[model samples]
Target: MIGLIKNEFMKLLLRKKVLISSIVLGVLCILLCLLISVAYKFTTKEAQIESQQYIIEVFEEQLEEAETEEEKNLAQANLDEAKASLEIIKNTPSEDDPNWRINVEETINILKEQLNGLPNDSGEKEEIRKNLLEYQELLNKDIRPMSEMSPKGINMLGYLIAFLGSLFTAIIVIIISSDTVSSECTPPTLKMLLTRPVKRGKVLASKFITAFATSCIVIIGIEIIASVIMGLIFGFGDPAYPMVAGTDYKITTVNAMIGKEAIAVFNSSYLSTIFSVLLKSLLLQVLYIMAATSFFLMISTLVKSSSASIAISIVLLVSINILKVIPYVKPVLPFLFMTYGNTTTVITGEIKISTLSSLPSPIFVVLIFLAWTIIPYIISHLNFTKKDILV
Candidate 1:
């Protein structure tokens, strides 16, 4: 059995189609990374970016230009001050009017009057009260800070590409595995194997192992080039890329979602996110391919020609892909193993997570879907082994 597994493993690694598929998938991953990274560089102004620094410098000049003694005082404030000022500008009321000035003047007066009314034991309260007023004024300014989080649209797009890759991966793996047992059972191979007096069960197990082994190779080969290509194109060492080896970790900041309220930005790191996205993406693909392979094996056992396997496999693939598109059925979408190919939803932090578990921890859903895949696989194997291949 071990020898069979080893042989199957070697068989797939050497298969030209498998090798090419893996390379292409890897290149795809790298290209995606590069594209996303470049988009991020232009869109999300980083701390070290020239534009970011230039913006800060221009802001400082504007503060100096404001010439009000308070503005000059704030000019000496650190990056935090610039950041705060920028935030104020970001949040400031928009309109062309002097009433904006009135609003500021009113708030300052109220703070001043209140401070004067308070009999201070020490001058500490007055200084703090003054700084608070200054801070408030800064908030009313027009220049805002760069967003700290990556653009939601872009990241979502990246997830989509990842998801698409996952979908195709399943189809590819299934196509490769579809001929495994069914081909052997279809013609000269089947009669020859039976004549060799190999146990029917052993033969079934070998075929199953062979198919599984091939699926694994397909996954590994595709991802290897995809990830590497993404890394090279994107050029490494950015904010999303983390320093840790942690898996399923999420990174967030005070980022805007679909509303005005500033929610904490949970910008999950790239590696774990990508890994999780891919794994989860491939998960459904794995299941679908399994089903495809099993179904074909069953057909091969029952039918007499390899050509029948091709037609049956096509029908299965098309049916599943089409069913996935139905609107009402989309919500229960994750149950379909082929659904794992959707890297987008799985990659994004769109879905709520339990504080008790890690982000992208669709563990329960995956387990259930896995059960769906495995049960059919086992049943198919049993059917092939025990039921006479009447063909």
Candidate 2:
């Protein structure tokens, strides 16, 4: 059994499709870092000072145009605050200065307080407060200092993991595993394998396990390669920097999650422990990769053409993601495994889509994936076990 797994993995590694896709993914990571670096240059300290000056000008115009006593007073107060903020911006040493974040915290807190006083019935006010809360959480997070936010910093890893990493993992895993069984039917391969006396179930299980193991390896490898390349370019900063993980109202640090201390403290009080939260988030990502792989595998078994299997898988994924963006389709998101791809936000109970009223809990996410995971395998298994091979 171990030998079979090894052979399966070896065959996977030798596939030119896997090799080329991985290379493309790596190049994409490098290009993303370059793009981020260029963007950072544009948003530097000088640009910020210029922005503050513009805000002061806008405030002055508002004060001059005030229509009533109440409006005049508000405009005057805003003008004063903008002037003060300009002074602080002028005095700040650099873009990465810790004082910048401190200044932001003060600004966000004041805005939050002001928004809290507004009528709750106003949708615009609620949205502003929500935005302010997210900003406040970022300011309060004990992660890397502002100085380390460059493209080369460890901070980029967080962004990479959350976005690019997730994307590449899904695409590469889907592409590689999509053809696992389907491609075998095209030539002499399927008959050759079944003629060896292996049970159909075991054969299918080996393929599934092989694909899953390959997914893990590919994801981990991407992380390692990204870290090394980015570290070489930007110099690796502190590894122990805290990653803020929670909604603005309640938050915990990455340090707490690693030691599992956050879990014990927040379990009864919060939805789940930090450890459970992160673990579930990671598990969801893994499940997503597996689910994508199996979906494609099932497609392969049903379609018999690897190209058709890949095309159908891509179309399904893209279509679901498109539907996820449409407001009316939000109710179906909970049932769709594709919507759970952003596991970190899901685990934190912060659904990114504004139209969605509530996010699923960790338990619900697990149940959704469990059904998805089982159904695909059953479809592929039944087809593979019963299908006639004429070649």
Candidate 3:
């Protein structure tokens, strides 16, 4: 079995498609890093001041258009808070100044004041309250805020994993796996291999193992290359930056000025460092790749033409993602492995589909991925072993 798997791996490595894919992936990593570096340069302290100014303008307009006494009060409060924040930004000596802690405390006080002004049932109240709590926690812990545009390698990696990694990995894995079985059938490779006294089941198993292993290697290799390039461009950055975990929202009745009203209460309790979250995300990504590979293999087994297999697999993967945002289909999203494809979001408790009554536990989502891996392989196994490939 080991020898057969090795042989399959060797064949996969020798393929021109594999070589081309690797080059393309590497180039993509370089391009993405360059793009992020450029974006980081634009997020300067002055840009932040400009953003605050824009917010102040928006609030001023809202205050002007307010018709009711309550609306006017809310808009005035918001305008005042925006101006205060803008003043703080203007007065700060530098982005890295130690006075940031003091500024954050001041911001917390401003948010608390805004929160108090908001009516009990107002949706904005909950948002302000959440920010208030987050700021308070940061001040209490004395942890510096990690800017999204920090130009750090680890931050870049996090952004890539969250935004681009999953989609790229899925497309590459689908292309490779979808061709694994069906491509063999076209070149008399299946007949040639079966004549070597190997059981059909062993042949299929070897192909499955090789595809899964190759996809994993390619994904991890690309990540490493991207990380190294980013690190070289921008320092590796601190691994101890705090990441919020176990964030969730619940709908509950709150006592309003008029009466009780249902509102969504947002909460996040656990905190893990960036390194820890990245580690967990990487592990989850591997599981997702396994499930994706197995599912595509099943498609390859079912479809006789390699091109058709690839097309069908890509369409199915894309369609599943599209379905995720459809309100009518959201109820079934928890049962789909694609819902957990963005492992970073899953780890950081950032999955916020409003249609989901509650988020699935991580363990449960892991089981869903495992089921996808095992069930599809079983289907492929049964079909491949029983079917006639010599025709």
Candidate 4:
């Protein structure tokens, strides 16, 4: 088994497709770094204050146009929140400020005032409360809050891997897995291997293992290369920078002026360091890759034509994202293997308002991924073992 796996790995490494995929990933990493750098400049403290001023003006106009008492109250609430946030931004000290802790305390006080004015069960109130706690915690720890758009090396890496890396990795993995079996069927390679007294099951298992292992390597290699390049350009940032993870989405009824309304609230449950969050995201991504590879490999085995296999896999991948937006698909969305492809969102508990009710627990998602990996492999193994080879 080990020898067969080694041989498969050798064959994979010799393919030009693997080299092209690696180059594509490396180029994307560079492009993302440039994009983040530009974004950071546009999101400076001064820029934020200017933007907030414009927002305040917009809200003031809305308040003037309010025709009903409820409209007036809603506009007032929004205006107040926006004003308070502007105050917080203004009061925020520069990095070199010695009395930054005092500024944070003042920000916390402002958030508390905003919290008190909001309705007791309002979603905005809950969000304000969460910010209050985070601010208070920062004060207690004597740590300065990092800007969301900070382009520190480690920060960019985390952002890239969480948001962009997983999707691209999946694309490459799908391309590779879709061709794994069908590509060989067109040539005499598969036929020649079958005549070597090896069980068809062992041969299929070797292929699966090789494809999975290669995908894992690709993921880790891209990250490592990205980190090195980013670190050289931007300093390897603070690993101890605070991060929030393990968020949970819950639908709650909030007291509104006219009637009770339901809102989706995402609560942060776990707090850790940036490094820790990145590690957790990568681990989840590996599991996602396993499920993806197995599922696509099954398609490759089922279709004897490589083009057909790749085309079908690409369509299925695109359909998953499209189906997720259809309201009727919500009931089964959580169970679908592709729904959890964004490991960053899954780990951070960031769900769209439309799909809040469909949030699946981390354990449940793991189970679904496992089911995908095992079941698809089983079906593929059965077919590969029994089917006649035309090669």
Q: Top TM-score: which candidate number?
A: 4
For candidate 1, write residues 1-391 as lDDT tens digits: 6665675567566667666766666566556555655665564323334454676787667676867878766665654566765554433322222344554555556567766675553333434363344435334443122122233332333443454444665556555666666656644666666555567677777767677657655654455445444445432222232111122323333245521111112122222323344445455445545654555555545544556765776676678778764545544654555554543444333322212123334564457455655676677666666544542
Clashing pairs in 4: none
Model 3 lDDT vs. the true structure? 0.76
**In candidate 1, which residue ranges exceed 4 Å CA deviation?**
6-16, 23-161, 164-166, 232-304, 331-334, 343-361, 386-391
lDDT for residue 190 in candidate 1, whole number 0-100: 62
Poorest lDDT segment (10 consecutive residues) of candidate 2: 260-269
Candidate 2: what lDDT?
0.66
Candidate 3 matches the true fold with a TM-score of: 0.80
Model 2: lDDT of residue 272: 29
- Candidate 2: the clashing residue pairs are none
Q: What is the TM-score of each candidate against the true structure?
A: 0.52, 0.73, 0.80, 0.82
Per-residue alpha-carbon lDDT of model 4 for 1-391, expressed as tens digits? 9999998899899989888987887788778778888997777777888899999999999999999999999999999999999987778853434667888788788888997787754567756766666667676666667666666777776767765543677787886687888888877777787778888888888888999989888876777677777778766776776666665555643546432223535344466677787777778778888998999999998998888998999898888778876756866877777777666666656643435453576677788889999999999998887654544
lDDT string for model 3 (261-329, tens) is 224343333666788888888888889889988999999998878888999988987898877666568
Worst 10 residues of 4 by lDDT: 257-266
Please, what is the whole-model Cα lDDT of each candidate in the order they appear?
0.50, 0.66, 0.76, 0.76
Candidate 2 regions exceeding 4 Å error are 50-95, 98-153, 165-167, 235-281, 352-359, 388-391
